[model samples]
Target: MFPENKKQLKLIYFNMKKIVAYILLVFIIPIASKAQNVSPLYKDSIQLQWVNEKYDSMTLEEKVGQLFIVAAYSNRDASHENDILKLIEQENIGGLIFMQDQAVHQIDLTNKYQTASKIPLLIGMDAEWGLAMRLKDVERFPWNMTLGALKNDELVYEVGKQIGVQANRMGVQFNFSPSVDVNVNPNNPIIGNRSFGSNPDRVAAKGIAYMNGMKAQNVLSSAKHFPGHGNTDQDSHKTLPLVPDNKADLEKYHVAPFKKMIDAGVQSIMVAHLNIPALEPDPKIPSTLSKRIITDYLKGELQFKGIIITDALNMDGVAKMYPPGDVDYRAFVAGNDILLFSQNVKVGKQKIIDAINKGEISEERLEESVKKILMAKYITGLNDLKFLDSKNIFEDLNSDVNKALTTTIFEKSSTIVKNDNKVLPIKKLKQKIAFVPLEQTDYDQFLTHLQKYTNVELVNVKNPSEINLLKDYDAIIVGAFLSNESVYKPYKLSDNSKAIINVLPQDKKTIFSLFTSPYGLKDLDLAKFDAVTVHYQNTKEAQVAAAQTIFGAIGVDATLPVEINANLKEGKGIATKHIKRLGFSAPENVGLGKKNF
Candidate 1:
């Protein structure tokens, strides 16, 4: 027993140390977990300590800087990067909102920006549908209108979770998304496809699911254009669109979803730059600058305890009405905790500082917002900073899982509003069908997929008299490929094309396939067609899904997200049971033994 045994003694010492460490971990892990579980808005003990300590250490200039979130672009040159760096170092700006960038470039820039800041920066993106909205080559999820068509709210939740996961992958803290503007106005220049649907209750339900899903991944969601931008005829980016509804109608149609989102504990609300005389008596004052709208109503009446953010200060909606720093000061005084995309950060910060010195804004008021910003950063896990490793990031962002989810979303969201005489799921594969594209556009994918089930002829036509050429086919499938370049672009058919469409069903069994926003349905006469199917976008996935639905490879479960006309109201969809005749598969299923596929 007295012999020296170095190896055995060392092993015994290591085991004892491990046992002690395990005992410590047992107590420490739960405490950390519990702290993390606490809502940042609630300001638990640990969060309060960090928020207060950070607030106390900051100077007035730094406190003022914390309220401004300037825009950043990875796609820009070195001069832009240097400017952003200057803001972080000199001005001590609060955060960044990256726009229109490449995936790898954005990630690398995020790390560089985060490393340069004295305090952790809160990175956000306008990724309403996903990063594809602002970043190139990322997985593009379905638009909110597409998601609104789904009967299952859980699917929409999964979409939000996936978007959040991708945002987190790129080291982003916030996503300005789930535009809960119940799009009741078809003439709305923006917020068409961005909104879930026209139904306020449905919009609120989907928005709540999406918000919760993002929260599950620690990403903050901001419900936008509050008090609603749904009923405006003009784009807020261009002018201060007047929301003309009375207070009761505004509450019923436009503001209902925002109220519901507030009730559901959404982390942020972006005040719109709209002139609503009903909510705010002053017709000249936009909601973003009105204390009655933001402070008294949203914060006081509705009791929204979360951070209030203003829409971009550079937009003409508010920018044209005020000078450079004036708009930011007004939004701040009105109750917005964060001023987004300020035209001049230097001037804005100076203006805010001036207000504080003149006693127009109390130091206590400034401290409240600054502390709230710090708490948000802590909640996003910025207290313990970790830079993103760019290895396989592009591939990881557009993984197989993302593609599969997208395919399922498109398939489930293919809606058929009318099927006169039940002409859908064309059972006779041997019938002579002509694929007529209404516009002078590409329909190769649609035509090819249609031919997968049966032989179809292509009819190229320019005039209304071309309807005569389609008389040879047993049935006619008309495909309208509308441009999705911008929401402001015209989605209606030309006069000549419209004439052909109206006359085609009178003589032939015409099936209309629309691949664009549902708002365009107002221009069309739905009652004239024998069958109508809507695939919301012109992507290849939508094209293939539209073909599958026509041939009965998939059934129709999606309903109209927005009301088109009096006849085609919201929730108008004809659910089709899947027929056994056709199934979707690889070409190999019939490739080997094919006798003309």
Candidate 2:
């Protein structure tokens, strides 16, 4: 391996098929049938041209190397030596994507890794929200669900720009982010907060805003899990999830944000390991390996001319869904431009080589993708960027801009659901208050915050039979912040929770303030409680929002996105507007939905 800095390679990078076309056109130049043309590399390098003069100057191996992206580590020690050097030298891989685990070492690792390679690497990460999401030793902003309540699209965009800043500081070129999934299913385990919200148009607006923010900082944004991974009941990481929906549903909900971002000039699209029956029939074949969807819908119809990358092939979604014959080869055939994180590169390389030898995957397709890969490198100014600038990276990595950006988002999202009798702003509660802390040890901070507002009565119902412990106060407010969603869905009214409410004097006034999802309201007897307010998130902002709304200090009208009842009708508390609204208003009072933990 040539371990010199910014290593240069003597290899070709061009679309062999396009080159052949030009050649045949050249041979027919008896009457001068062609314009003076340039190479793809030359075209891409200067002024971001597609048909330039330098493609003709590169070698065959350079083009092949550009099509592959190898998984690499940034460790300075020899721990990263073998795989990093082998791929960079033998494979001439075009780029690297850092995992949270891969970036634990210092930033100096970039110089060593880049020097070992023959080409300047374009680095990327799955830093959806920020660097803190994946990498350890970094701060995490609020998750996406809390963010959805915030109405400030600009804040969301700023988050992207800040993520780009940190990533770029660490030598990353792309941020695989702004997960455009519209989270309609609350039971969706993987993509809940990862999504912007439950509305497609809202997600689209946020996606465009975030993309613009990323573009402001020159980071290529990728809209991922194409089609949409929000409504499915299964986790792709475990098995291929088949999202059965008609074209109308897809266009209306799932494809809305993708179309918006593609129009906004997103640089790449990362395919997910999902099985949409309407798009392709292969029960086991994910969209990452589906030609019908990737080529027909994404390329032809959408007209996206940039690169297409698959999510890590090592993910169980691809591993369990694919067979042993190097599914990446199938992915290439299906129109993916980069084979990201293939579990075994040797196997992947051999399979692709065998396919080329057998002529099953034409060399023309390979060359086309290689040209795209090179074009990305050339246009990103990878050759111009100083990837190893370590002078003040530690101080600049997580700049103050990120903390402010996160704070902005949290501020806008806090919302207030309902205030039946204008008891919020603490004037009403504090005047004649009895804070019945939902007596649970696991949530000390939640109760500790509850204590700041009112006097507490740790109401513990010894048994259902012992119920009069809650009778003395003029008004009762229950503080139940530690409840989880699963604990409420099948809906069990906590015997103790109901017991406390049960013992309250028949003439005394009482209310239930659910701090998690309003679904907890279903667990309690809603009819029995005099006034009920549901604040979906329990963040301090949510609490404050709920508090303000309860007293008319903030207007309380945020519509609940999920069902909060088994009462009125068969499908009672389900919000009908959420199913089809482009963007729905949350049960907002103050900006409670905006804060993140």
Candidate 3:
């Protein structure tokens, strides 16, 4: 029996036949359903037939090429483009994962590369939150942790659908997103804000919701960092992260979301570079390179029939473990359908060809992976390849509709974790209030919004004289905007900021609104504040939402998705009422239909 939340239980009853098929797969039974039905992106038998036809017509070298999905960049020079062109023309690389660049540059390069390729290339990106994750000048959405705060999973689905829409517009086929890692470890360096939450069932529900949204737009979704990368303290990009959980623990926490995702029909699963000792006994061996983990466990035990991809091979997690050609070939032998971001495609391809020729890697195994790749290409409508229309690219990506849905998500996600003394909804607007901005960068947005409600004085907390002046105010509204750059960056308050916060009058009402990760609370003393609001990230929408929440312009409905300390447990939220005000609304909203909710 599969683990199901209340929502999922209702979903099971609604789609009983699909649930039955999933149950049968758990017992290793072959699904008789058509491939089109397996994933919503597939239209009919014609697509499946086309996949077979393509696979049958492919040469041995081309079949080998289908397994390698090399990395590309829109910000690179002609040399890089020429290299990629060579890979497409000679090596016949099947796909590409576009890295950081602008939408226009990426689209132009994608067109150029596709034109050079013999077969239509499968374009993919790591657009977890949105296109802004890997591109410049694109609309950015709230992080998964922010979305995790909302009670409604449907909003999270809209986030995915919008991301899919943007990806489709940019000529991307696969989106390596909806990271289903159950982030239980607060110290987890890589998958902190990227993950939905620490709860397995919640993560599973959110992952499925996101995948289905992408599927609606015919943009394939990839549930990533598989078997789980949630509990590690180390970054796989630098070195291998060892997950200490045993088999039973993994099944309960780590593998739960991946299982649910597979059942919901995810197109691909990106295997993390973590060294999971419970799944594979070999010490220092990345899970991406372990045949026992990828082939025997994932394919055999878990019964995952879709494409299995390795996380970027260029990452030191697996790269440091073996030579240039060895790791890529090992990944192929380990049952990965796509070798993503391989360090050396030339050597890797030759080694894989050698392995196949010598019967080390069987032809049947090679064919199976190649066929899956072709099926994915066909399902994504690559069979009818079309050039990406570059008209209104920037304006379309940053549309009013996208901003409206994003604002709604931020409004719902902004939470009040500790509102002691009922300092919030500062009804006494007549009282003296001072807004102290604490951040590395300028955060005038919060101050700007706060001034709209009341005559709030802006005080630079960096100065010692200003810290002394804060005591004169009836309430000190400390707006701390910590950076959410990468998990690798320190997200705690600076010494100067901490000193200012510590010096603030404990007796006076201090409304501390943190525009950062909730984990940022662990570094500061909670006793210092009269009230605390966790606004997840310092996005423009979050800044406005925090201010609105303070003045009772909007109600606080979100709860903490992750625990900061013992007193502030997960899902801890204090509700507040909204005051009568002229509220703003976008009538031309994109993904905010009542049917979705």
Candidate 4:
């Protein structure tokens, strides 16, 4: 074996090594690759078996029915219930998204509908903040804008988990929440407070955290209103809103959060009724019905592999574009798995069947969405159909733990955006303080909380002439509480209120507490106030927190989540000293555990 010549020896050695390398490649690489792929498949084998079996068992009509998730109102009368029963019996609808009603009523209705259906129906809700978002007699969490103000995103996660827990207890399989839309446009009528904030990164981070928390509770989460509804001023419920950004701008801003959510394995996404010319060329066609937008951009480009749900079909946004049956058919063709809130489920079902018969909608396409729906049902454990326990549901939803968390959210979310002359902490008791109410409704709690610290005079400035009466007080505390019925309502101050604020003596210390949207301050001159605080909502907890912050009972550390104007930007907060009587406690003491739910 010893070579006589060096060149011949080297060539022989190289040939021998090449032969060994080929042997290893032929044998080892395939086995390694097979193992890597097989491992994931093994992990998913049970789910795959269940999905395949259930999908195979489904009749064509049943499979078609699975694609429709109609709207149910717990607050409706007997006629509505009978109508729903008819749809369930005739159309065999697969799911229902519960709308406004009492929690108890919803539970009863859900059980009734489930009994009527041949297959177990998946129940969902728009419980973004909590069950109280749609139903009465249920606990309400802080709005998304309020949650956005917190520095600790962990709290946001806990909020989501808690909401999910309530949703699960109420038998909601899916919670269409964590609206990942980045609210860059402050004037956005529909999505201002519903969205996390103006920053895409922050919105994405918060949305992922929330979705994960909900997922932990076995309640599927949906990142909503894609590609984005945050830039539109028109409410989609009434009309179609246009997202005027090009694809590049959308990817950077509007689509950023959605991309993050999809990458994080979000279970579902709600397609909005928006017109984006860059993505869909057809004029006046909604993104909900645009194949280019849904199939091409979201599914193809983004590679999203989950249930794609359309926003409520009853909304004028898509309803105006097509007739009743056509709307559902177009949305189905556009790649949406669930046709939500169809105006006429019977008609919609027939239309879809007709389309499928005509080869417009392929059997493969129908099976794809139907399989996803069945898979979701399996994932939610609906295959094992268990009725919700109606007893003590309200007590479970509105627990002491939830109340403590609500208080914590308000305390952390209330921001002291402007504090000139250091007028907070109300240290000098010698100065007589007058509490002026500039609210549509009575804000007795705010005044009552202030009165606990010192004897404060109440002045109702309904007219301009009442402004002069405030001059006697050494310091005037203006409490502006706005109605929190809907986000669409005008949050700005009235002209009379503005005039009253202007006539107030600038030299005198005037503390302005705004228990409304931060945008309400945009109309007023910030220089006129000695101190300015934003409560961000008119909730009683917020009122109490603002009052406590004023009297130095609680420290103010929350930063503005969104910009009000040029003078105030996001994250603008002024921390003030607490009085000697003030105290603090850990979140754990209030039952918000560090461990996951």
Candidate 5:
């Protein structure tokens, strides 16, 4: 009898320890979930039930409306609002993709649109680099090309997570991003900086991280321009770009990333308006409207079960091919779940209705897409949707955390391509250094930051006649800045700029820093420069990071994401050891203890 009491006491102690462990587990899980990916929405029973219940209550016209995601803009006046409202009221469109607008304004319009619609509207944006891509004066992450150079995909995940956090705060449901295109072509007018890199493996790894990061915040992501938008010389917005690669080569290079994305359980894929004869037999038909490409291949062959969305139907790649209603019908028949940026919602909805009525398209087909859209809405938390409290949204979106993360990304992505004779880190502080601006934009931040480490003289020479003035310095640091980093803009240096760089004095050690895409390095002979660095962007943070790296405050780790030429191929980077001249310390330790600078 005494033995029984002792055994019971031992069991109680074990149970107490288990309870403590359980409590710790609950608290620690979310903290360690930064790298975790969210499960697919369609797999959840509760969301499916909500979808079924909502689908049962919908009329045929309402079901048809769920397929259309129309374009919306906050930059417009009451006329635009009234126009969008009319479509919501009359056509019952399912969603809105906000284009260009300020952060607060977009939130306000989102609230107004959601209230006006009978069904809670799904809001989407082309925020590949966060809302800063569309909105002004907001927090911005680096482009995909910059991110591709990063050795740590975790940093890319963090970038995606931050973008997701900001997007969720603004009530955006979908981020039509992570263009999983492999940029094999240097002259790709559209996907130059938008793509991760030339390597399919690198693109896939980065795309997976980005997709998972957004998923963690319950924001749906679409790996876009599927089949792949990279390797095309022309912009799809202008015309249908041709991808001449055979099936095996296409699979090896362009389509590889998309396959990886799908395998990684990407929630959706946006079909590109590309013409690939290897995949689609008809050259006239773009992938967006091809049954063989979308239904047979992407859906059947790839076994992708997620939502298939079309690229903006208004783009010239598909828009010029057919009229509004006809093109929308073909896209639906081709098996896209969402028709994005439909040219005319009214005509498209009516066309689908007519097709359903005539038995050309079954009611079951309509139900499939409508139910899927409803499931997405429920999964994105639209069922318990709360109107955003805009009082501190601007401040929240541009928080210290956002700025710090962006600065960190800039630091990590800076790459040194050439450092001959161990000339980097500018070890000789006693040597006279001249800061030359080979840019149309301002280089004040770069110059100012350079002065923090050592004495530097500013040299402004716009033409060859003024170049003689630079002969006095022991070393010349040239900042080749690109003001407009747009893909449509010129990335190559001007003839005059090239002439000045090429003719720089051979006697003086010349170190060149490019503040633009690595593709700009194509024409210039990089051999002349004793040391070279590619910072990718001309932003203040990038400028500061470049300066720090030059002075050995930070070491270089990022590699070239794309090939500039045969010699400067992909994955080329010079890893420089840190000098620790500007090391981390407390403010007081550095002789500045005041709270305000």
Candidate 6:
């Protein structure tokens, strides 16, 4: 049961059914599993002795099936439900990870699947920041980039707590998130903004704090892209990334945060699709398939007893390296417990079946991985909290309290780095001012709120020349927003936007409002702009907060937790504005929070 966004969910269901059918025909070698005379609900730790004994009784076919965690869909048209049932009935596969779209109707689908298979599936998610981080029609919190700014680790825990609540309600047992990668490279297109921050200590602390909330909620969390994937410019989703660094570099900059996370009692670590010569010199193989790194380093050196899961098998990084079926075989040998997003479940099952028959992949190894996966299941309480009545998330998600915390973080963070304005508290609210929105839809709702305090003219500026409206107003307030989005990089006013802002009347006051991450300020050429106000998100709250700061309402204690440039030290966001409306009253709706509160 994917999102009622029926079109995409149905398509995913289609592929799932087809894949399940293939597994059924070849690998449905039914082997009856006698329930260990153990208690139905495992209260304490899953008795390792009983589990090992139970696993020993499983037939060869059942053991092999335990290694596969196939993707499935709910569309009855493809009818893969029976295929999954056959495996549970026969092979006893481990778990399933949902995609962005698979989140919809997840509860009912899981119920139906569990009823057919008679085995509880360890449901997983790429809830990197939260479940909504990837899914549509869901509430999306700010990226880790914004969280990195506030330096409030407790907030991360709150976020994790909320994530656990939402995900658990949807029957999710594991959350693959709190990317432990310390972002040292600004140019790192993929992990920069997703990381907590650049400092190893901070990244470690923030990651641990977030995990605190998750673990407290009993949500299984997996610290990911082992060794660290934050420095590479390559998107492994497209091509294999190389972490070409020496052991010292890895230990100092990259591995530090991960070590911190592992120490924090994390339940799992996801090996990246990286090729690092320091750990595994063979560029021919990815970390996901290299025993040298997976077993020798991750398992032997780090002593991570928890399950090791591979990133999505469909990713170009792994897909290009091995055929679909072989990826499963190699990943198992590499010590991974789960073969995520196994693109070819049918062929993959047979490969495992063959690997075991030929002794290429030992049955002992298969039992080890499967046992860990299942143990993880018992530990996560999935056996007890199976399927909750599905809630219509559209209304229940993103409550007002959550948005206020986001507002406090973002608004208090919009520091004024440089303002010659003594002109900022603009002396005259009676002055005509231009409201030039940076993006086509930049805080449109907040613009209406600006009318409450100011006697000003709001001008729509699509091109730089639109700054001509600057002639009519005494001061120019440029609501220029930027992000890590590919197109927005190397941000500049452009020919037309620049020409207009540059030619602004020198006699009049000018204030530049930067509503994206502050790192974007480097591209703005601070010399031309008289004042800079950075209200992190482009959310309506960001707009309202930024405008109020201009008029002096809220106290400004906001600062950057990370250094943006050589001149800007860590904790150096410019103190630009203060709150106008008084009191600590919460907003009616959090999703629209602003800096003005």
lDDT of each: 0.85, 0.63, 0.84, 0.83, 0.86, 0.69
**Tens digit of per-residue lDDT, candidate 5, span 1-597:** 333687898988899999988876886455334212333446455666788888889889998999999999989899999999998988889999999977788888888988999999989999998888888778678889989999999988988888889889989999999988988888888888888999999999999999989888989999988999887899889899999999999999988899999889888899999999999989999999999999999988987777889999999999999999788988999999999999888888888899999999999888877877887898789999899877898788886666766777788898999999978988899989998888666787889889998899998888887889988889999999887445355677888888888778889888999988999899898877999999887778888889988989888799999988988999999998788777432344345545336
Please give the TM-score that candidate 4 achieves against the real structure.
0.88
Quote the positional error of residue 409 for candidate 2 in Å. 2.7
| Candidate 1 displacement at residue 339 in angstroms | 0.4
Error of 6 at 400 (Å): 4.1
| After superposition, candidate 4 runs with Cα above 4 Å error | 1-43, 583-597
Report the Cα RMSD per candidate. 6.1, 11.5, 8.4, 8.0, 5.2, 13.7
TM-scores, one per candidate: 0.90, 0.76, 0.90, 0.88, 0.91, 0.82
Per residue, candidate 6 scores C-alpha lDDT tens digits across 201-310 of 87788788778888777788888778899778788889999887799989898888877777667778888888888988889899889998889988788766677888
Q: Write candidate 2's Cα lDDT for 1-597 as tens digits.
A: 653443333222235567777876776442232221222122212433432333454455555566667666553357565677777778777777776453435356566667776667777777776776556556556555555555566777777778777777777777887788876665676776577667777777778887788777777778877889988878877777777778889878898889888877777888888888888887777888889999988888877667788877877777876653377777888899888876665566677777787888787887778766666666556656574566765456655555555544443454434334543434533545555655333444434444555565555545556555655667766666653322122223467767766665656566666666443565565544566665544555455544443344344333333333445211112111111212112323223343421
**Regions of model 1 farther than 4 Å from truth:** 1-40, 486-488, 505-507, 585-597
Q: For residues 205-227, could you state the per-residue lDDT of candidate 3 as single tens digits? A: 88999998888888888898989
Best by TM-score: 5
Q: Estimate, for each residue in 48-102, the C-alpha lDDT of model 4 and write its tens digit.
A: 6787887888777878988888888988899999988888888888899999988
> Candidate 5 at 426: error in angstroms?
1.2
Q: Order of all candidates by lDDT, from best down to worst?
A: 5, 1, 3, 4, 6, 2
Best by lDDT: 5
Clash statistics: count for each candidate: 0, 32, 0, 0, 0, 18
- Which consecutive 10 residues in model 5 have the weakest lDDT in total? 31-40
Give me candidate 6's TM-score against the actual structure. 0.82
lDDT (Cα) of model 1:
0.85
Q: Which regions of candidate 2 deviate over 4 angstroms?
A: 1-58, 73-81, 102-106, 321-325, 353-364, 389-398, 436-467, 482-597
Better of 3 and 4 by TM-score: 3
